[model samples]
Target: MADTIISNHGSSEKGANPLPANSVIVVLGASGDLAKKKTFPALFGLYRYDLLPKNVKIVGYARSKIEEDDYKKRISAYIKVLDDKVKKQLEEFLSFNTYVSGQYDKDESFQVLTKHIEELEAGATEPHRLFYMALPPNVFTVVAQHLKRNSYPKNGGARIIIEKPFGHDLASSRELQTSLEPIWAEDEIFRIDHYLGKEMVKNILILRFGNEFLGASWNKNHISSVQITFKEPFGTEGRGGYFDQFGIIRDVMQNHLLQVLTMIAMERPVSFSAEDIRDEKVRVLRAMPIIDPKNVIIGQYDKSDDGTKPSYLDDETVPKDSRCATFAAIVTYIKNDRWDGVPFVLKAGKALDGAKVEVRVQFKDVTSGIFKDIPRNELVIRIQPSEAVYLKMNTKLPGLTTKTSVTELDLTYKNRFKDLHIPEAYESLILDAINGDHSNFVRDDELDASWKIFTPLLHYLDENTDIIPAKYPYGSRGPAFLDDFLASYGYVREQNGLYNWPHTSANGKL
Candidate 1:
């Protein structure tokens, strides 16, 4: 892929085309925390790696009129600079940045932005433009329309990157896609769901299709259940106002975990191209039926027993009688020939025991008369905190006794890729945007298919305000009924021993 595209240093390779010399990346909502923490830091990472074209300009657009020095300070605060050389690179990256204050809906503001970009690209050839919308959903379409109408490059190409929470439900999601698809071509719009860029998430395909052993047991005949979990230890500290509008389901389970589930359950694509991969994903999602509320469990966090952490209601920004769920566990089934009757459980929560995200694929138990009640095999792919791929299997005890133990064949990236720098999810996505690689980005039909599976449950949860959620103390794993919920779906839990991979047995870390 690197050889296919020219680097920002203006390389003259056989098949690589030099990046537009006059490219400009404009960061909308530049005064917000997303821009400062994620968008700008990602841009800086690209610049430091020499992946961004030389002489390309970066513009910051927002409604706030902060001082240029202050704006620069906020955005660079999150960039990690190891030494003086990287420090100087950060200084140089900041040099190309300039700020402009503008309203999202007004055309005059976009015109001003266009004029500034034109002035910056006065003498350079192929003045390409990229607009990054770091703003709230309410302003997404308005800003996109204005950018297309007023600031769209005439002689060069233009691309726009938009973030997730595309909409609250299926109807709204379709509306969002309908409104924007007309203004921007499908190829030019980059719908970003940052989870797709995670290192382990990207490796799922290689882990499944590249390895015959794992791929062989990836169907209903060999697998019992699949669980995708996202847990966060801390609640929304001060962003309750935004978080309350869309609870844990919309925040994590609906998009992020569901995306992971699709990757796990989809059939192998014909090719590794963007459309082929996404086509397979859409097929799997279309086979999945709308989630049943009966198979769903919603919970709200109460104050911890230690009383150190705050509950959902304790947040001043949240409504006192809010029925919003802070945690959710949903069961969905794909009625395809490959995964028929197998349960796929997606769970997400805030203020849980710890922060972790992983997919646990539990294989069916051994059908034998030799050993009494043995635990089933499980393949675990840890997506974050500590990236690893471990397969839990039964092994004989060292002694000459007819005993068995559960151990894992592990692949921790930290031990294996010791010299490799694992790029942040944002860094990977931004680089893909620069290279025009749409493989990691979301497509319109993908969004529609995903929403179709969750919209009915969302509507039920919204209408039934009188129904109270299960209360779990902050920092605990989850509600008491969580185990029962899993059991209902024929999910078995190991009751014998503490299972710790990579750190347990000697030579297991490999």
Candidate 2:
């Protein structure tokens, strides 16, 4: 039997606090990389901020036969403590932690695990339960079913947290859902997309809905096109085996990129509830036109001149004859009342020139060139490598030659707010799950709709290997044809000298 420890914290004001501190959390696959590097650290961060309930107990479940102290030691190796104060706080929080060894597929093991949790929280005030699946997608259903059959609390709030890649495509996702539906309700299941929890990603909603200036111009009449890009400089390294299996399309474009696009394009919800927000997002996703093959481009990294890195096929883990795409760029269209005829281009790759994640909304050029020298207006939302919002528009030059040049109205987080710590993506997401705020969680319908749009392209690529991925050198700005790809659609690359997309379409053309 596990020791039952009790701790008390301040009470909440009213219905605002739906979950209690005495809630029990069971993290399946607690020994995995994600659990050690992300989940435990995130939970500790929340504990340090007192965002978690004081009486809470975390049960680390895995098949590994490790002692409690040893497990903590292993986790501590990767846990990041930015300050000495946080280090001390994390130590205290870890005291309430316990571990349970169990075979994922065995019922008897899960029952024992349940009894241990019951003993640990024997005297807790509330018996709320949250089951977080940190394991791979393959074991999600098994763990969910076991928990439902043997461990779910009969009373109070019961929730399950699932991580992505939810499924390879729609059918698998639906099957995954069906397997869990018997155990959890839609409201009780939180499907996390870490990108949705990013500080800047959340700001997408705040920027568009909270500000009058941007909101007024966010429509088909004023915007030309929206471009979103997620690029990284590092290749797959030793992880090419997994990368080859999933490819850039399913790995990044399917969930992260699509979620970002939906957030930017969705109509304003009546309330900020999970369902309300997801409903609007589904509408936009459903409205997105089927991707035209002619508008899509794919690429793979070629060996560098200096031979410092291996190409995709050269990686030993990846099959030599594989035709998986390492890079994907597509132009999407959203046919709706507010965004009809607008072009939304999305581009993502593993090894690129620099680490960049940004959304550029290029506004239509001035109908009448009041200032002959003025450039087009634009709004940029930089999500990573830096977090900032900039409004680019025409402004009079200091000199007197009647020249107008583009200038930016910048609001940078690091510059304006000094020493402020934005929590990691996992931290924000775990905290939201603890609080039962599903606003950032993905919905089942949304997942299905996303797969519907991309499954065709995925199958098309799998069937046709002749559409080979273009070869581009590592640390370069992708294939040289990127500019020509955009040019074919009547859009000119901007002065930023970078070929990327913005958060929302600036002028609604592609």
lDDT of each: 0.87, 0.82
- Candidate 2 TM-score, C-alpha based: 0.92
Worst ten in a row by lDDT for model 1? 9-18
Model 1 spans > 4 angstroms off: 1-19, 505-510
lDDT of 2 by residue, 253-343 (tens): 9899999999899998877777778899999999986677888999999887577877878788998888888888899888889988878
lDDT string for model 1 (1-510, tens) is: 232332242112123223466689999999998998999998898887788877889999999988999989988998888999999999999999999888998999889988998898875555788889998999899999999999988778888999988999999999999999889999888899999989999889878887898888889999999999999999878778889999999999889998999899889887666778888999998999999888999999999989998899999999999899999999999999999999999999998999999999999889978877788899899998889999888887577786776787888889777767788898988877777777788899999999999899989999987878899999999998899899999888753553565544532232
List candidate 2 segments past 4 Å from native: 1-17, 496-510
User: Could you tell me which 10 consecutive residues in candidate 2 have the lowest summed lDDT?
Assistant: 8-17
Task: Report the number of clashing residue pairs per model.
Answer: 0, 24
The candidate that achieves the highest TM-score relative to the unseen native structure? 1
Q: Give me the displacement of residue 32 in model 2, in angstroms.
A: 0.9
True lDDT of residue 278, candidate 2: 85
